[model samples]
Target: MSAVIDIEELRSQFLDQEFDSQEFVLKTENILTVARASGETRAEFSDESHPDFQAPPALLCSLASGRHLPIDFPAMGGIPMDGGKAVTRHAPVRPNQTLIGKTHLHDIYDKKGRSGRMILIVARMEVYDTDDNHLATADSRMVIREKPTS
Candidate 1:
């Protein structure tokens, strides 16, 4: 019996799979580096002791999983695209503090496109402090586009 496999089933294989936690200390140099690039000069982020010196929110992207998010979609003659992402900040991440992050497969859904079906994979990343306090949660969605018919 040959039956087409659904993308949800493929994703289930990785739903229980988890990645190693990544831990790193947020250095002031990095904060300033991003500040210079993002033009975020509120003194709190650039200065170490400005009474509200906190690491830039976007800096949390560095703590994201370096490896690809666990998603094994069915065969598709197409390439994956950025598709954009949505990040949510919990507690403020401070400078010079070690932060630990863990990522896992969160959700997967599909939609019909003009060319073909488009599958969207959403992976969640959670970051915490050395003390085990949750700091932030980031969910990134990537879309796999089917190759348009000639």
Candidate 2:
């Protein structure tokens, strides 16, 4: 597991500070393979279908990188762990379309637990199409546990 982080310190650093938004432009090719495997049929994602059949919901959910979580969290460490769930807004993605994703830190909360202190980090991500149309929005939550050390 990673060294226990000072939650207070981290909080202070982010308090009232605006996190720089990260924007990513993804091409259709970047997501097609996984989209297809996720049951997104070619007909629904073909150039011919453009502006018509929307991208499957599952495909968009699968695109998340999950890199927002801390590297040292126990569950994410060498030991097995369960990550938090992501709530997605219903939307469709189109084929041959370029999508842009914008990510920002939403909120962070601390709680007292049996192990010690636990921190919950929430991030909001929005995906848009070339025309700036909203495709989907996801609120991803990550839980990190802190254990006391002698």
- Off by more than 4 A, model 1: 1-5, 71-78, 147-150
- The lDDT for every candidate, in the order shown, is 0.72, 0.58
> How do all models score by TM-score?
0.79, 0.57
Per-candidate clashes come to: 0, 2
User: Candidate 2's residue-wise lDDT over 1-150, tens digit each?
Assistant: 356656666655554343333445445664566556666566655444355545555556544544554333224233213345464655676655667766655676777877686777666667777678887876666666654554
Report the alpha-carbon TM-score of model 1 versus the true structure. Answer: 0.79
Model 1 Cα shift for residue 59 (angstroms): 1.4
Count: clashes, candidate 2: 2
